[model samples]
Target: DSLVKQIDAEIEKYFSGENPYRFTQESRELYKSIGGTPFLDGDYTVFGEVVEGLDVLDRIAGLPTDSHDRPMQNVVILSTKLKRK
Candidate 1:
């Protein structure tokens, strides 16, 4: 939840700035108008990077990207199991 808290703090900062209207629902509407897609990209301690099936992710990333660079289809993770270290 740290990431969520971080993003919330940033949103609050934006709302408190001089251009207060920038934080309105219309701002989100403007993003939708431009077809914006937000995503997280990075390594986090709580959820480590995939140790296997990385090639699959690469393939997915290589697929023809949309205007927002997201793959056309959704990729589902069937299951995951933790192994003894």
Candidate 2:
């Protein structure tokens, strides 16, 4: 199935100096302050980071959701791309 084919197991790092891309000190500190799960460092996969539009993310995350956590309103993916140096 195409959906099954799209599934992949890839490791992603959430900390600086570990992944191909680095998160800012501010972000790292924010993660710590927010009590992010650093304990699951190597367990699951992260895949990518959001370099911008975090404000939008916060707004969406703050929206009321159902028991399953799906937003009551629709959210759409407009575009996405990997960062390149």
Q: Which candidate is the best by TM-score?
A: 2
Write one digit per residue (lDDT tens) for candidate 1, span 1-85.
9999999987887666544333468858776787543322133234454678888888877888676566788777798877655
Runs off by more than 4 Å, candidate 2: 1-44
Residues 1-85 of candidate 2 have per-residue lDDT tens digits of: 6665444322323222355435699968988797565546557787777899899899999999997678999999898778975
Instruction: Evaluate model 1: give its TM-score.
Output: 0.40
**lDDT, model 1:** 0.66
lDDT of each: 0.66, 0.71
The top-ranked prediction according to lDDT is 2
